[model samples]
Target: MTDSNMNSHELELLIAAWLDGRLDDEGSHALQNALRTSRAARETFRQYARLDAALHDVADTSAMLDLTKLAAACVRPSSAEQSPTRAQESSDTEGSKTERRQRPFMQQMAKGSRVKPTSRKPIASLRMTPWYAALAVGILLVAFLIRGFSVDEPGTESIADLSPSEKTINTDAFSKVSLSKPPAPVAVLSSVEGVIWADSQLEVGHAFFEGESIRLEQGEARVSVGFGAEIVADAPCSLKFLSSDRIQLHDGEIAVDVAPWAAGFTVVTEEMDVVDLGTTFTVSVEAGEKAETTVLRGVVRVHPTKIEGEPRRGLLVSEGQRMSSDGKGSFVNVPQDQDEVQKQLGRLDFGVTGPYRPVDLSNTGQGLSTGDEDLHWQVVAGPAGVFSEPQYASVCEPERGYLPNDPDVSQWISTADWRTALPNAVYTFRTEFALDGYDLATMQLFGRFLADNGIESVRVNGNPVEVQSWVDNVKYQAFGDLQFRFVNITGGLVSGRNVVEIDVRNGMMRTGHVKDPPLSPIPNPMALRVEWYAFGRQQGIAQADDGVRLWRRIRDSVPPMSMLSYAGPEI
Candidate 1:
C-alpha cells in the first residue's frame, strides 16, 4: 500500500477502536494525531462514535435495530439521491441547518437524562460537502465490517469464521481496535461459584461493564447490576453485556430479577428480544436455535428480531406463560405448569442419586444422638454462630432445622463480641465427616446460616462445589430461617473420609440503611449448622419415606414451638 493508503487504513482502524472504547493510550494518541492531520479521519470518528452512542442509549422499541440499520440511518444518502431542483436544494440546505440547530439541544437532553455522553469532539456543521459524503459512505461501510456484519455468507457467520482474505483485509484495516479488553464494570460480582470463561479471569469482587463478553464454562454467577437488578447466569453459556439494564445471551440460560427502579431490563438473542415488563424472567438461547423466554413472575415481551417482514411484532408473555421461537423466526406461546417448567429448566431438580441419613458434625462431639441440647449449642453458638441469646422480641426465632426433635434443643448460647463489630463479614463453619467409600449415588447436605443478604458455597475434599439456597423465600425472610443445600455431590465425594466446608457471608446491618426496628444490645452472630444424608445410587430416594430425611418433607413447617416467637423485629 502507498503511504497515503496506509495512513487512511490506519485512521479507519483507529476510528473503529475509539468508537468501541477498545483503543489503548497509544492508539488514542494516534487517533488524535490522525484527527488533526486528516479531516476524513475526524469525520469518520465522529460518525461512528455518534451512532454507537445512539444505539447504547436506545429506547425499548428501537433497541432491536442491528448495527447495519443503525449505520445506514446515520450516513447521509448518496449525491445521486439529492434534489436537482434549486428549490429542493434550498429545502435540503435548510433541513441541514435545522439539524445543526437541534444538535446542542440533543446533547443537553442526553445530559439531563443522566445518560453518558459520547467521547467525541463537536461536529463542525451538518452541511454535506461532496468530500464528507464520500467519507460518510466509507465510515459506514467500515462500521458494518468491524461490527461483524457479513455479505454473501452462508447461514450465520461468527466473527471467527471470516475468510482469510476478508480477515486479512479487515485486520489491516482495523488493527488498532483490541477486542479483548473488558469494559469498566457497571456492576459487581455479588456471588459466584464454579468456573467462568471470558477474555479475563473474574472474581466475586471484580467489576464488569457493558459490551463485555462473558462466558460461563462451568458454574454459576449471581451478579448485581446497578442497585436493582440481580442476574443469575448459569454456566456453559455465552453472554454479552449491552448495558446495565440489558444483556444479550448468545447461549445458555440466565434469570434476572429487576426492581421497579430498573424496569424494562432486556435480554437480546439472535432470533428474538426478551424485554422485561417490570418482572422476573429467564431467557435461554442455544447455537443455531431460537430463544426461549420463561416468565417466572410478572410479564415479559418477546419480540421477534429477524422476521422477514418489516414492523415486526411482539407478544406479551405473562407469569406461568412460556414463549419460544424457532430458528426460522416463528414464535409460539403456550400455557405451562410452573412446577413442570421448573423441573425442565433444572430450577428445582437436585439430580441426587441415593438415600440419606442425618449426620451431625458439631463441636460438642455428638454423633447423631437424638437428645442433646448443649451439643447443638456447640454447633450454633460462639463467635460465628447466632447471638447466644435472642436479641429481639419477634415472630422470628433461630432456625431449628438442624436441631434434634426435642424441646431442649432451643437453649441459648451467649452473644460473642464480634457480632456487633463486623458489618459485612464472611464466616465459615466446617465439618469433617467420615465416609466409607464412594458407594453412595447422591448426598443431600443441608446447613443453616444467619445473614441479611447471604449465599453459601461448599468445598468437598478441598474442591469447590455448587450450593443452592435451600430456603425458597429468601428475599422476604432476610433475617428468618435460611439454609443452604449442597445437593448431589456424588462426583466430588471420594472413597475415604471427606471434609465439607461452608462459607456464609453476611450483608450490612439494617440500622445503617433502612431503619425499621430498635437497636439491640448486640447484633446477630453469623451462625452455621450442617447435616448430611446419603443413600445408594441404585435404590433411589423415596418421596413418601420421610424418615430418611427429617427436614426435606417439612421445610416450610415452622418449628413446633411450645412458645410462639415473640412478635417484633427478629434482629
Candidate 2:
C-alpha cells in the first residue's frame, strides 16, 4: 500500500513479498518500479534478505530431515515375534540392516527430495502426539546438529521449531535492524532474494556455500571490512551489494571511505574489479547485471578481469574519477557528473551534501526558513568545487559542525522571524519569480524543486525516503528550454504548514514493502531570499508571477510570500 504514513520497514516488507513470490504480477512489477535506482533501498532489501535467511536458518531445518523415513521409522519392528535362536540372528543383522536402511534414506535426504510433503493443514501435523513429533523434531535437530546448525548466538529461536507462519517476523524486521534481534548468522540460499547483510569482514569466501553471502538487495548500508574480508563467488547472478558503502561498493553503488591504514579492500562488479588502494570511493553493481565505480578519495585499481583470476589488466581510476564495467571484456572510464552514468549506476542528480548537516544551514535553532525543519537534505559532491564555493571537499570539511537534520538535534525551529547566512549553493536566489508572494518561501523551495526534478531519492525527515524519479515526477513544457517540475499548490506555503521536501532518491529497495505515489510538491522546509513572481511554462503555474525581471529565474518559479519575513537583528 502506498499510504503516506508507510514507514521504511513497511515498504521493505512489501518488497520482500514481491521477492518471495507472494505478490501478484501487477504487484510484482509495481514493486520493481518502486525499487528502481534506490541504492539505500536496495541495501535495505539485502538486510531483509540476511535477516530472513538467518531466521530461516533457525526455522526451516525440515529439509535436513528425511520425513518419509521418519514416518516409516515411527513403525517399529515387533519384539514379541522373535524366538531366542532367531533373535540372536536378527540382532546380529539389526545394526547392519539399520545402517543399510539409513544409507538409502541419507542419500535421499541429501538430495532434498525424501522429506514427506507437509500436510496441507499444518494444524493436523501439530495435533499429532508430542512424543512422536518430539522424536521427529529430535531427528531433525540431530540432523541439523550433524549439519552443525547451531547458531553462535542464543535465544534466536531454533530452526526446528519454526512454523511456516512465523516466517513473516524475519521479513518484517528486515529494513530496520534494531537491537531487538541479537547477534547471529544470516544466510541466503540461491533461490532467496534480498535477504542478507555484511556489516563486517568476511574472513573466508566459504561463508556462502550455495548462494550469495550477503545480498545488498535494497536500502543502503555502511560496511567496513577489515583486511580479513575476502569476497569471492562462482555463479554470476547470486551475489550482490547495493551502494551503501562509504567507499568501494560490492553490489549496488557503495561509497567507501577507507581509513589511511586500511588495506586489501577489493570491490568486484559484473564488469570489473575496483580494488581499494587505501582510498574512499563508491562503486555500484546491480542484479548480476551492470556495474559502475566512482572514486571519491584515494585511488582504485581497475584492471580488465572480465573473468576471475584473469589479471585485472586495465587502467587505474584516480581520485574524483570513475569507471564502468559490466563483466564484459571491455570496461569504460566513465567521467564524473555524467547523467547517464549516474542514472545507470544509481546515483541521484540532485545536490546531495554527503551525510546530513543541519547547522550549516542555520544557527538560531529556529526552523531553516519557511516550513518544517524536519525535512532535511544530504548532498554528496560528485566533484571538487571552486574557491569559497560549496565544493565537495569544502562540504566534506570538519568545521561544518554536526549533521543538520540528524536525530541528535533536540530543538526544532519554528517558522517565525529566524534567518542566518548559509553557503550560496544552499541559499542562492533570483528576483525573477516567487511562489505566490512569498519570496523567502519560494527561494527555499527552489532548492527542493530543482533537487527533486533531477534525482533518484530525496530525504524528507532525516531518513532517506522514496519518490518518483525526475522524468516520471514532472509537469513541464518548453518554457524557453528551461524545464521545471512545478508543484501547483498554494495554501501550504502561507503558514508553512504544507511545506514539503522532495526525496531525490539515489537508489531503490529490493525487498520489504513496495509502493510509489504521485510526486506532489510539498511545502518548503526553509525559506530563501528573492523577490519575483511564480511562473509555470504555460503548464499550470498556480502562484502569481508578479512580473519582475532579475538576473535569473528562481528554481521552481515558486517564491515565498512577502507577508511574513524577519527584520534584521533577531526579529
Candidate 3:
C-alpha cells in the first residue's frame, strides 16, 4: 500500500514483518516512504530495531544445538551398515549366530535387554541413542521456558495490538528508563570589578542559569556566555539571562563582544533587539524613553519591537554607526562617538593578577632606571648626530617646573646635565615594549608625558601619531605650570615588539642680556618625564598579556615606604 493510504496498524505490521525478515517488496517500499516522510514512523522503526536486537541476543545465548545435524543423524543412523531383510533372515539359526557375533550390543537391545557400557561415549557417537534424543527435547524445553519468562507474559497484548502512537509512547518510556535530566547553566560570571549586586551576593566565577535576573548597583561585570560571546554590564543595570545566546537588558548599558562563531548573540531591550552580525556593540536602555545601539566593529541588525498595530523592519548598523529606537517604532541615526565607546570597552575589569607586569615609561616609581642591566630608554640621537655607543638616559632632578622628581610617581631623565646640553640641539629618546600574548585587535595603549624645553614630534613603531605635545616652545614655563600631554598610541602599536620615539628640542640661548631676553642667556636645560601604560585583553592567564593584571602587578610592586604610586583610572 502507498504511504498515504497506510494506517498506523498497517505500518506497525509492516515494521514487525520487516524486523522478522518476512516483509514483501510492496510492504518494504511503503515502510521506507513512511519513515522518510513521517518522524513518528522513523521513531517506530528505531523502537522495532531495538526490540529485534534484544530478541536476537536471547536466541544466540540460549539455542546452541544444530537442528539440521540432529535431523540427519535421526534419519540416517550409523547402524544402517546391514540390510533389514538380511537381519530378519539372520534372526534364526546360522544368520542369528552371525548377527550375534557381529553386533552383540544391537542384538541384546533388540531383545529388550538392558546393556551397561564400560566407559562414557562422545556426543557424536551417541546422537542416535534414545538418551540423546531425550536430552535434546529437555534443552529445547528449557530454552523456550527461559524465553517465555524473559519476554511478555502469555495473556498480554502484543505490539501488533497497540496503536502506532501508543506503541511510540511505550517505546519511549522503555528507552528513557535509565536516563536523567539536569538543569544546565547558561552563562558564567568571568570577571567582576567593584560589582555590588542589588539583593544577592555574587563573586567571580559564578554560574548563571536561564531565566535568572541580575541587578547590578555599581561597577562593571563581565559575563561569559558560551559561543565566545561576552557581555560587560555597567552599573545601575538590570538584565535577565534568556539563554546562552540571548539576554534581555532591562535597564543600564552593556557592551557585547561577539566572536565570529557567535554571530547571532543578541541583546533584547524594550525598544529593539540588537542581534550581532559578528561584531562588538553596546546596547543601553533609558527606562521608558528609548534603546540605543552603537556598533564599534563589524555589523549588527537592530530589530524594533512591535508597537500597537505597527510592524517594523530591522535596520542594519555597520561599524562606527549608532542607532536609537523609541518603543513606538521610530528609528533615528545618532552620531557615533567611538572614543567614548572605546573608553567603555576599556572599563571591562578582568581581575587578572598576573606574572606579566605593565610597561612603565616613567622616570620614577619602577620607571626607566639608569642602573638596570636591561635598559628601556636609550638616547638614539643627540648633538653628535648618532651615538656610536648606546647611550642610556640617567634619572635626574629637574631645575625648573614640575619636572618628575624622586618624591613623585615619575622622575625626569636626561642624557647629560641640562646646563651642559647644546642649545638648539634636538635629542631623540626611544623606548621599546612587547605585547607578547595580547589580542592585538582589542588592545588599548594610552598614556601621558611631560617634557622640558618642548617636544617636536612623537612616533610609535616608526609611525607618526597625531598627539598634541604639552609644551612646544623652547622657553621655560613657570614652576607648577607644566601640563601632562595625553597620548593614545593604540593605532600605531604592533603585535610583538613596539618602539616609541620622542624628539625634544633645546631652546636657543642669547649672548648680551636685557630685562627679558629673546632667548635665555644660560644654556638650555633639557629633560623628559614620561608616564604611560599599555592595556589589552589577554588571550590566556599564563600569557601575561592581561592589561588589568599587568597594571595591578606594576602598581603593587612599588615600595610601601616611597611616596610614589601607580593608580589606574577609576571605573
Candidate 4:
C-alpha cells in the first residue's frame, strides 16, 4: 500500500514486520515513504525499534517462530467487515486463531498448554536477502515474537503440545515498553548568595539541564557541573549550561574550576572559546564589546572566534596570564592582575578560615582571655567575676600559650583565670555583631576556641548550632598553649544584628579536693579564648564599577597587532 493509504495501525504492523525481517520490497518502500512523510510514523518506528531492542536483551533467542499465525493475524478481516454466514464462520475461526496467537508465550508455557506439530518451516530455512540479513543483525532483532513463540527442538514439547490458552500472543507488551529518554541533569545550583534571577526562580540544589540558561541579576551563584567542574558566576552575568563539561557565557564574569577529570571543559563566548586544560580560570564578557580570559592555575587554550576566510588560531594561556579579545576576532595579551585574580579566587573558595573574632571583642583583645567593660562580651547565664588572664605553668605542658598577635584574629577572652574557675559551673558568654551590606545566605562563621575546661554548647541568634565534639563528649580543656577547639557556624545567622552565645563549662577537678590539688593535676581555668579565623563573606560580589574599570583597562592596554601571537587552530 502507498503511504497515503496506510493508516497508523497498518503502519505499526508494517514496522513490526520490518523489524522481524519479514517485510517485502513493496512494504519496505511504503514504510520508508511513511517514515519520511509523517513524523508520527517515524516516532512509531522508533518506539518499535526501542521495544524490539529491549526484547532482544531478554527474549529467548532459541524459541520457534509461528509465521503462519502471525501472518494470519496481520491479514485476517475484522468481524465488522463481514456478515454472519459461512464466510463469517470462517472469519470467527480466523479471529480465534488470531486471539490464540496473541497470548503471551510465557503465561501459556507456565500453564502447560497443549502442543501440536506445525507444518511451517523453521526460521533457519527462511531465505533472507542481504538487506533483511543486515536489518536482523545490525538494527533490530526479531523480538516481535517474544510474546508468541513455540519450542522447535527435537525430543522437546512443541507449542502444539501446549493447551489452547498457551497459544495466544501478548501484543500488549509492545505498548507497555517505554521508548522516551530519561531526563538528565547536567549540573546543580550548589550555592546562591543574594541572587536575583532574570526569569524563573531557583534555589540551592536545583538541578540544571542541558541548554538551560540563567541570568544573575544582583548576586552570586555557584553551579556544580556533573562532570567534575564548578562555576561561580557573579551578579549581572548570563550563561547557558550546554552540557556537563561546557557552557556558553553571554555576559559578565564567571570563575570556572575544572577538576582533572574534566580537563576539556569549555566556556564559549560571543568572541572566543576558553577550553580548560585541568585548571581554574575566569572568563568575562562585556556583552558585544569585549571578552577576557585569565588562567589562575594550570593552563587553558583561548580560541578567538573564527572570521570567515581567516586562519583559525588559539593561544595557550598559562597560569598568571591574561588574554583579551579585540571584539574583531583577534586576541591580545593584557597585564595579569593578580589582585583581581585573588579576589575571584576567594569567591570560589568559600571554605572557612581561622581565628574567628568574638562578636563583642575589640581588635585589640588578642592574647587575653578575660573580657572587660570595654568589650561587648558579657556573662549572660553563668557565674560572673570568674574572668582572668590566661597563665599556663610548666605542668600544663602543650597547649599552654596563646596564638601570637595576628591581624586576622582578635584576642582570646575568658571569664576568668583557669586557677580560680575550677568549680563545676556553666558560664554563658554572649556577644552581638551587626551584618550589613552582606549576603546573609553566603555568610559562614568558623573559628576555634581554647577554654579552661570544655564547651557545653553554642547558639547563634538564639538557635542552637551543632558542636560535634561536645555532642561526642570530647573535652575542650586547654592545658598550656592554644589548642583551640574547632567550631563551624553555617545556620542561624540572619541579616542585621546577630547574637552569639558560647556556654563554657568548667568540669570538676580530677582530684576530689579543689584546693591544694597535686601538681600532676593541673589547675582548671575558666577562661574562654576565641579567635575569629574567618567570618562573614569570604569574597564579596563583583562590584559594577570594578567590572567597568576592568573593561576600560583592557581597552586602554590593548597591545599593537605586531606584538600579538596567533597560534594555529587548537588540535
Task: Please report how far candidate 4 places residue 412 from its true position, in Å.
Answer: 66
lDDT of all predictions, in order shown?
0.47, 0.32, 0.57, 0.54
- TM-score of every candidate: 0.31, 0.23, 0.33, 0.33
lDDT: worst 10-residue window of model 3: 159-168
The parts of candidate 2 lying over 4 Å away from their true place are 1-252, 286-289, 303-305, 308-315, 334-571
Better of 1 and 3 by lDDT: 3
Better TM-score candidate (1, 2): 1
Candidate 3 lDDT tens digits, 1-571: 6777878898899998776566777877889999988888889889989988766433322121121334544644354353333223324355343333222243243455755433322222321122322333344445667787332221121111110010011123335221001112445566777989997777664656444578999988887664447678899999987554688898999888876766888898878889999888889998998899988889999888755676667789988788987766788887677787678557654334221123334433244344332256777787774334557777765553343264344667777555456555678888887877665543445445556556767899889876644343322232121244445565676678888888876654321112222332224567776665444444455344233322222221211211112111111
Give lDDT: candidate 4, residue 71: 52
- Colliding pairs, model 1: 185-208, 355-534, 355-535, 356-533, 356-534, 384-526, 385-527, 388-414, 394-566, 394-568
List, residue by residue over 186-275, the lDDT tens digit for candidate 4. Answer: 565666789999987776746564445788998888776656576788999998765546788989999888766668889998788899
Cand. 3 TM to true fold: 0.33
Most accurate candidate by lDDT = 3
Cα displacement (angstroms), candidate 1, residue 42, comes to 27
- Per-residue CA lDDT of model 2 for 541-571, tens digit only, reads 2123322111022222321121012111100
Question: Each model's RMSD to truth, in Å?
Answer: 27.0, 28.7, 36.2, 28.9
Worst 10-residue lDDT window for candidate 1 reads 160-169
lDDT of 4 at 58: 29
